[model samples]
Target: MKNISWIGIYPALLTPFTENDEIDYPLFQINLDAQIEAGVDGIIIGGSLGEASTITAEEKREFLKYCVKTLEGKKTPVIINVAEQSTKVAIAMALEAEELGADGIMLLPPLKYKADDDEVVTYFKAVAAATKLPILIYNNPVDYGIRVTLAMFEELLPYANVQAVKESTRDLANITNMLNKFGDRFKILGGVDTISLESLMLGSHGLVAGLVDAFPRETVAMYKLVKAKRYDEAVAIYRWFMPLLELDIHPKLVQYIKLAATAEGIGSEHVRAPRLPLKGAERERVLKIINDAIANRVALPDYKNL
Candidate 1:
């Protein structure tokens, strides 16, 4: 099995698009380079933050190939997300991701339909059985409406490839619950940016961060500080980051984050149809938050050196 350490920061990266609404390879590469330089432990592509619903399968494949080729031998593993509505399509995509050099998979419950516990477990098991690559189950019941409760994860214990989970249930207790019930059987990564420090402080292995797409250095520095037991310093940065981090939870997060990244000179705010760019007051409000954070951006310690 290809080894992908499910620890430290993993950005659920944004898919940069051109003015023509096509994948902007140049801009995407710029953002990917930013994430790499910030020292993210891993990268997740085609996630909800990546606007997976709007992205075509062919586009996803091309993006994955581009990322794989770009990240070649950099020691940064790229994990492709599988959020299909069909068992067959999910399995096929998982297999193709493996074939195309993805280091791992971030599997979500079937999209559009809320599968009951048994059905959801079955979906996960089927995909796990089909792929030898390591899997990080994307467990965001709050958004996806299909919660992978502890009982359901018990059903997945037999699959060695189902190695970790993106714990986005928005319930902090779930972190300790996973630690208490499963021990180290599954690596738990905090999936929400707002509660990331709390999650890490509670023993989550790492984070699948959202705002990190634009503020990668701050995200990485905060994680390193937390791990190094520098609580005060980490809290200082998290406090400054909270306002901008709040952008990840909103419905227009793609636009909000894309705009933030654009402000940081890494990306553009062009999203696919049905999700237009922020306009009027909404744009100003989000820009104010981003600008305030930038103006008050904390001088990070030598977290990388530490």
Candidate 2:
């Protein structure tokens, strides 16, 4: 119900699974605290990076409760992803998230089914009407195959709770178009992990970053530097970060990111089934990339301390 500002590096926190593929609540709590402690602006509880598709409804609700409880009295607002297949299910999740005391919800137009534009628009509006929680419109057509265009935004015009958008269109022009067309009506959070610097350089409001899961402080440091108008410094950090950030857009992003996060000591290299752990040549290659970064990790300058 409250207006939660959607900006800055929302890590899209990875869900830690146990050795037997159960939800590891304790490890999830540790990862959440590390991200909040590292100074991210907001926390998106269950997102694509969080492996929301594989996570059960009960797990989602429990995670939302965990976020609300752990981040109690904090400025960092916790938002959960509601990417259900049915409108009814999505609306139910939205209402439940609000009831469970989440700061906001991110809606990714009915997952799995390639719904038509009008159908997608209607689904988003219905969920918006079902709850008072502030909503972030996740427009990642690249992965979801339903790009929420400006026309869709026009249809969402009636909903005051449609406060922000996760722009993963992977096109810088879309950012300009959204800004020029809507003129700040919707806050824009860069969704693609690889192009975060480009997004901020072109004036995006902030980022819903994937790389932040592994390198929380480094991600936050880049955000702080960019916002402070230190473009050169920000670019330097981005240059060093791009190799790992690009992992977020890959096919095995779940496995890759979990490995990276584990390397940082915040989570386990565990993923729910249907998705498996990286192995053999694929495993060795990914580990080398992650290990190299770990060895020469950026000494993020004072952003956390200051």
Candidate 3:
């Protein structure tokens, strides 16, 4: 039992927007309040779920500042994603997040070019040197084209700030291998919703779930059950929520999530340019699935304008 104690449910929150595509600070506060009511242990701001790439740097800073202000007196921690294309940018963002009173920072590997092990280690070391707060390494190979191998992690773990890793790779064998090797040194969090239960069983500390944006209560219940050593109950809830989680893997994930949230009155389905809302049969299908889930009393958030 090392000091790595990140467990339970953490929502990879969506960046709420107005119909005009501006960041809705009010709606964002509403969403955060809802997550707190649902009992989530923490919230992830400006990750993939937050549409970080579409958000400008200034908006990112504002969002972190607001989250810090809003969550100041609460027990729920806020982890700000400091991912950028360059190491210097990442370092700058991490320092800014730390200054904003963020509890921790999550980072992605440098996205421009594929770096060797030494380069990757150096990148993280530089980021670690910039912040005294905890750092969660986000290993999203699909998006960044860089895979952080275990050897690379071994080299980077010497930096005292690198405390956690969000393993988003699709390879379960690699996940199991990492759990076997460095489970003590790092708090491993599951990034994929479908494999979350498996990840927990395999020694992951918890999940930073995208689906939790829609079904926070159910996700929180699942986490509590798993943490209580109640796998059978946890698997039952997972199976029930499997359809909703499957929707996240679609290419139109941002669109689908926004559509689902809109249907549930949590937020609008307004994605930024280069990503549009779900329309035609795709939109209809998503609506039907979410509607049916609600009709079946699947522990949904309050849905309006059905």
Candidate 4:
């Protein structure tokens, strides 16, 4: 299995699409470069923010290959999201990610089907058994309808490759509970952007951020500042970032974040069908928030030196 630190800002990268609705590799590379320059520790492709459901498996494989090839000697790990409905397919995707040089895989519970606790564990265990890549359980019961409870993780303990978790439960105490119960067993990453700082303050290993696609510098700065115990500096950035971060919690987050990224000149608003560009008052409203933040964007300090 590959080694992943599972620490610092790992952007849940937004998939930039062309007006033709295909994966925009050129634009994608641009955003990837920007992320790297911003000091992101890792990259998560084909995740919720990446509009995973609409992205074809072929596209995902190609994207993974592109990312691996692009980051060849950069020392940044690219972890693909495995959000399949079946254990077999999930395992297949995980294996493919490993084959394509992904450092790890973030596995979600069986998608769209509300599996019980035991079934969820079985699904994760089956995938873990099939792949050598490290697994980060994406525990977002709020949006996904299934939570990988601590007891469930206890069952998954035997799988040594199941190394980390993207904690999006919106329940801060679970952070403490995981630490109290299992101490350093699984690295915990803050998944929700709005509460990510709180999660870090509670001892999360890192952040899987959404807005980082557009605002990578600030996002990375916030993480670096927090880790350096510069709470005041981190909080100032987080305060100005609150409105934009809230965009990650919505149902139309893919579109919303894409708009923000577009405003930053890093991405476009193009998206796959069944999902469309934000329009009418919604577009204007979201743009106002993005514009306001840009207008008053905080001047980042020498976070890189921290």
Candidate 5:
């Protein structure tokens, strides 16, 4: 694993699959290499964008092992999401990720179960104790049913490794509240794509981006432009890319993003079984947006090949 800053474009990865229902390692390597080439700060594995629900536990372990080996010499860190619904499984996965040499872990509140504030806090504490790696609480309350409320975070304060949060609450006011209540206590990374620019402007340290899985160069450019305080330049790209970035919120996000990635030559559009590839009108509509973006594209000197 590389030296992870936890404050930059750390794209949630989209796993590629073979028609035989196994991981396409060659295609997966292509995606990983592309992120490294495009200068991403880190890469997150087994995320929602990676189709984690459909991917098996064994596949996740293999993916983590492969990433730790492939990224051995690079400076990019590998962080995996552990979304198990049970605390026991979550702790086991967290320990395995650390053992596999992952730099950090992104954890969601127990999936499919509505955990109360105390249960959520206890779950976090147990997993935090099981591993020494940095833990990024995936706090997307809208999509995940369970909210990591301020009161819950108050309890998580004791665990030093649980300082960062992938803030997807979509409430900018909450961002202000977090900063006000416990300034710098959490390294908030904007998890939603459309509001990425706003989050950065509101003092987010970085973006745990989705569209960047395919449009890495543009994503990095936006982040760099914002960091440079060149709001105009960043907004210009954000305006052009917002349509595709919004795709991250759709139901078929994995397929949509894989297409965008393949269009950019970074990933394959082969999603796992439970999810089928987009076809007919839906396919054309998404392709039109992706192709048009490619056609009337930004003349980024560094991204022309992409």
Candidate 6:
């Protein structure tokens, strides 16, 4: 397996859906094009931002296939998020992604039930063993209630395919410790949008951001500034984007982001069951926030609206 670098801005793309809650393949294509135009380094599909938890295993496979086919012969690498409740299911998805020509596989800790560090390590090793593709470990303790300790990541580093990690724990010390120890080996990607700039400044290779699903241009611009070593300019952009990033922690984040995308005319705000659309005053409030943010230059689109 080739080494996959998780550098620069990679949006955890939201799944586009029609009003009937069916996958809108055309809209999905448009969104992908928009992201590429905005200059993202890579694309992450079927992640938390993509509502993977609500999607079936078959849907996941189809989505990965579609993405690989769509981006075929392109420079952008596609990373498929294959985090299922069952390790077997996750491994199956990983193998399917590899077979479909995906560049890498990203996995989250088992969310249905919390497991100890040893179990988590074993789970990742099993998934990694299933395919020769590069693997990215997604560590989001807040959402999964499970933490992959620094030691755990250290243990998994021996696996040649385990090349990167998405650290969403929001603990600076943990990030510092990881960078201090394994900086040369594993590429660290900041999973939380809120801390993306800070994480980059602190030596994180890139961001796997959900907010970038809505504000790709600004997010990518900030990363570019940092890449140029212009800390002052990057901080200004980061501060401007703080409010939009704050929306990622919202319980209705998927709805909020989709609504924001709709406001920009990129896609619909339609989400799956157990994740209903924003309703009543709450809907209006979020819509206004998204619109106002766009007006104020927080979430500007790269393309001209029709």
Residues 1-306, model 4: lDDT tens digits = 899999888999998888888999999988998999999999999998888889988899999999999998987999999998899898888888888899999999998789999999999999999999999999999999998899999999999999999999999999999999999999999999999899999999999999999999999999999999999999999999999999999999999999999999999999999999999999999999999999999989999998
lDDT of 5 at 34: 75
List the candidate 4 regions with Cα displacement exceeding 4 Å.
none
Clash pairs detected, candidate 3: none
Summarize candidate 5's per-residue lDDT along 144-250 as a digit string, tens digits: 88889888888889888886899999998878888888898888899999899999999898999999988888888888888887788888889889889989989
lDDT of 1 by residue, 165-260 (tens): 999999999999999999999999999999999999999999999999999999999999999999999999999999999999998889999999
Query: Using lDDT as the measure, which candidate wins?
Result: 1
lDDT of each: 0.94, 0.87, 0.80, 0.93, 0.87, 0.82
Instruction: Note each model's CA RMSD in angstroms.
Output: 0.7, 1.4, 4.2, 0.8, 2.4, 3.1
Clashing pairs in 1: none
- TM-score-wise, the better of 4 and 5 is 4
Off by over 4 Å in 6: 298-306
| Model 2 lDDT tens row, 11-51 | 78898999988889889878877887888888897787788
For model 3, the stretches where C-alpha displacement exceeds 4 angstroms are 1-4, 298-306
Candidate 3: tens digits of C-alpha lDDT, residues 1-306:
112256777888999888888899887776677778878878899987799879998898888888888887778888888877788888888888877788888888887788877888899999898788788898878767788889989987678778888888867776778878886788888888888888888778888888778777778777777777777777877888887888777777777777767666677787888788778998898888888776775443322111
Can you give the TM-score per candidate against the true fold?
0.99, 0.96, 0.92, 0.98, 0.95, 0.94
Model 4 clashing-pair count: 0
The ten-residue window of minimal lDDT in model 4 covers: 91-100
Q: How do the residues 170-194 of candidate 6 rate in per-residue lDDT, one tens digit apiece?
A: 9867777888998758888888878
- Cα lDDT, model 2, residue 183: 80
